[model samples]
Target: MTTAAHPLVVRARQLATGLLGPHAERVDQEGVPASHVKALKGSGLLGVNAPTEYGGAAAPPAVARDTAEILAGACCSTWFVLTQHYTPVKLLASTELPVRERLLGPLARGELLSGIAYAHVRAFPRVPVRATPERGGWRFDGTVPWYTGWTLNDVMLLAGVSEAGEVVFAFTEAREQPGLRPTAPMRLAALSAAHTVSLELNGLWLPRDSIVLRTPQTKFAQVDRPRNTNASPAVFGVAYAALDLLEAAPEAKETAGSLRSRLDEARREAYALWDHPVPHERIEERLAWKLRAHDLLRTTTTAALVAGGGRSMALGSRAQRLAREAMFLLVQGQTAEVRQAHLGHLSEIP
Candidate 1:
């Protein structure tokens, strides 16, 4: 339902080609500068799917997926930092709360960039973080093992399990203050430029009004379980980027073409399943398509490196950078169910 020329999608294209692609190699080494984020904010691609009432594009899923693919292909680090903004937008759109009126407009208008910290809740039994009810608010403790765009984020949607078996997600300024402190950025295989960090929350407290979603664990899992079943559109973006590198080498064009044909089919299946209204339906098919996308991403990236031969070993080689980025994408947003499915598939022998 989204057109290629959707203003937001076109903006994403312009950002990717004009800024992200050219400086990606340097950014990969020097870290994503604030200037790159400034460009994203200027593009308004940050609110590609936010409600139009807030001056967002309110574009369709097609536009969202298209822009994701284009931005990720150019620079996954910048794409990742911006990607965190959409989840908060989606969550706010569904809930009628004081926070919605307070935050949605700026977030949707790209005036504020938010980061996500709730994925840790996916590790349910462990409850890595906890929120204990206090007088006017809740006290958050324990550690958030993974938070991307740490210092670059203006706000973060932090989550912790409560004594009543509810997951409490609240928003707060993203910085070291009170009981919230962030460790140094992690050294990672890829997208290190996104500035990943771990947060130690000793007694961080937010007023009850700052709370967004406080749903029972069961309901949260039901919705969260299927989110990663289908391969993310970013997977296709990185996969095709590798394919582009491979195709550039005349000797590898035939192989790249064959892989591209297969990737196309897998993308179709994965995206079709993503568009299904029922989130819990056809999960097996969704996981299968996810696995297929991961497989193609690995194969395509590896093929690119092989085609580049020794030149791929250079730090500046696009082939090398794409390969490492592909590695990170394969595991990013991985869930226990998805992990089991992927490991189970890999364990099978010919």
Candidate 2:
């Protein structure tokens, strides 16, 4: 893994072990501070997948995933906040839009961090957020149910469905503006430190220049559907952290060894399917991998809690925190199709 890990991934591991892990418990209760964000910026870890010309590593997918595991395992709250930035970077880099020149460099250089308000686009027919064209720009109206990294992000790549059934994606400042209102961050079962919020957009207008990518809603689904079936690297990271806890507790060391062997084999198979040349191919196989990761993540984190005994009940304990995080990951990025498939597939297992 080290040989596959780029210098950026190495830097991520150092930051995670040195800083993020030490203070993860504190931040889990308090919130990911500006200092944590600053460290990410300074370390240049923020641009692992961005273009090298814009001060990024542009590293391979495995390298990116390796860094993801390190950071997410060390401090999921902070990792949650940073993960939002990558989508915008990737989208901008792929497009030749006017906004590309304006924002891609700053984002890739780690000078700017962005969040996503675009998940709502998944509710295709409902259109929680709508985009209508105007003379000056596109006007966005409606509510975004879940927007992560609220105050910490400099900008957000917001998406809305237009009348013509196109997915309208545009950039806007993360701060509250004339038509953008952010609700106070909600306390969650986990990752409350990431500052999650809901946004109301009555008339948020972004100039045409701010527009990044647009495609038919159906086409968007075509591209997005397969992406969610893969196991997230962060799942393994947290599972590994749980395994670490078990390894440290002398009684659970034997169990930890067995789980580690299974976990490694599961990860190898899952990632192989994830890297398949045709993403839409082997759909069932991918979902099976997703379930396996979730199963291991749940099992490992719960085992960690068991190893901690009564002390694990403490709100500040890493065991309890990891358990809560495991709950969050189960539904993270879940789509209706994914949900149905995951659950329906589970019932047939018996």
Candidate 3:
């Protein structure tokens, strides 16, 4: 029997098709105009995963995943910016940190937009950002290699490695504050619309109350490994969009039909493994499906560009945009383990 669609999922799909898709190209060129951010804030998608007690839908995991696919397919740059908020919300909800009560209500109600500055923590062996104990709380020092949603987000969840060897995460304003300075947004190969930058934290300080989560580095990795195995929803969304483009062209219809079947197969297996009851079980199968989905994404996007011919090379073309987005997905969530596995898979090819 077919299940009824979730309301939040339906809302996300509507926003994707009606608002995000039409303006994606322009936003990519101009770097996420303010109007788009305004619309997103009003869309209520920012609170999709927030607790219902905080005026949010508290959507199911599948609802969250499905909305991601819709949003990313419509405008990846927008999707990338908004996606960062979910992690911080998840952290706050699970922790008893004081910030949870103050921020969760506002964040969940879409009163504030959030960004992330914790990816640098994934750089094991080398601590990119450092935290030292101080009077009121902790002092942060070092460079954040990448910080997205610079000008747009109201707050950020920043991370650092502490002297005690624990990973500490805290919340701070997402702008140039007393000890935090952001470089001009980087001109990236793609997703420049997200307005990414490098942040220099000379002696940034946050009160102990700002701290959200603190755990041994080992514990952090234990949690991150399984997450790294799942394929990003954006990959599936973009591949589906490209397939849609291909199907529109008479000569490419058959090619699109074949790729569609493969894409659906990969998507099903990937999501099933992703939504498993156990968080870390079937990890090997998850990675296999992730690689398979990645391959199909590459193939589907490449076919669209090929089908579009010389015109596809133009910056104004959707084919060109999707092609560049596919390239971004290749390394979007790259971890050392993922890179090693992906490379090993490539090396095995005859």
Candidate 4:
């Protein structure tokens, strides 16, 4: 039996096909297309998850998930940047009124596009990007590698260390600043079209007003717990796409069936978690649900590749691209080892 699409999800699918479909392949190779991002702005999709008070749709999490999955199925690179921007905005939506007034409206209206640059590498000193007190606001100096969609965004949600040694988020707009420079884009196995860039700040001055939110102590139990809900929907789309591709291969039928079943189970568990209180003791259990979702996606895509033989890995193939984008599922937020440890902790949480 086929599932019926919600009106909003139906709209998202139509928009993806009409505007983003023609350029999806090029976007995968060229990074986020500036024109495509602009077109999305015109479509009023940029504000899909924004609160209506700020001129946003105030889309529910499930609706947002459906939208993202549809978009990702059409173009993984575009959806990657789009989802990254939306996630930060979702966090911003939960902030104070002043912060929303200063940032959200412009963000939703697409007058401002934003990106995130968080520290992810292991060898990198876990030092927060230092922000020193200044006359009017603060002066920031540090580097953030892998700032996704840098070229396309007018603003960035930069995570840095404050003078007080707190992890702070600063909204830095791109302007004619002397110190800010974008480095050469990094070549990657997949999602190259997302235009991820490294940023260098040479004693950049940001007014105190630029500080949007600060977390003196981040409640990871709350923060990390719901992190996957938004992205999970898009993952579902990727799995669906892989399954669609695998349908042409006779050997892939069994693998595809298994993947579909696992995906359905993960979706049920994830939505259930969204409704219920996630106990601190079950943090690992929650993580397990997310990991299982990740594995099912990976396995489904891998099976597609294997079933297709040499053709699937050819340059410019969608299968190859999906495989590469799927890697993000593995490395994002937490590493495999970290996730495994959390799962172990959850098992012992009796």
Scored by CA lDDT, what does every candidate get? 0.90, 0.91, 0.89, 0.70
Q: Give the CA lDDT, 0 to 100, for residue 120 in model 1.
A: 87
Number of clashing residue pairs in every model?
Answer: 0, 0, 0, 5
Error of 4 at 249 (Å): 2.9
Candidate 4 residue runs with Cα over 4 Å from true position: 1-7, 19-22, 97-99, 119-125, 220-222, 225-231, 277-281, 335-350
Q: Give per-residue CA lDDT, model 3, range 1-350, as digits (tens).
A: 11128777787788888989998888889988777778778878888889989877788777888889998999999999989989988888898879999899888888898999988888976999998878979899999999989989999999999977899999998989988999988999999889999999999999999999988988998888888899888899999999999999999999999999999999988988888999788888988888888899889999999999999998888988998999999899789989999999878868
Using lDDT as the yardstick, the better of models 1 and 2 is 2
Model 3 residue 93 lDDT score: 81
lDDT, residue 177, model 3: 92
Q: Tally clashing residue pairs in candidate 1.
A: 0
Provide the TM-score for each candidate, comma-separated: 0.98, 0.97, 0.98, 0.86
List, residue by residue over 1-350, the lDDT tens digit for candidate 1.
Answer: 34687887888888888999999999898788988888888788878878889878888888889899999999999899999999898888888988999998999888889999998898988799999999889999999999999878899998999988999999999889999999989988898899999999999989988888899988998998788887898899999999988888999989999999999999998989989999899999999999999999999999999999999999898989999999999889988889898999999835
lDDT, residue 336, model 2: 91
The sequence of per-residue lDDT tens digits that candidate 4 reaches over residues 221-245 is: 2454455332366677787888877
State the lDDT at 59 in candidate 1. 85
Q: What is the overall TM-score of model 2 with all chains considered together?
A: 0.97
Candidate 1 wrongly placed segments (more than 4 Å): none
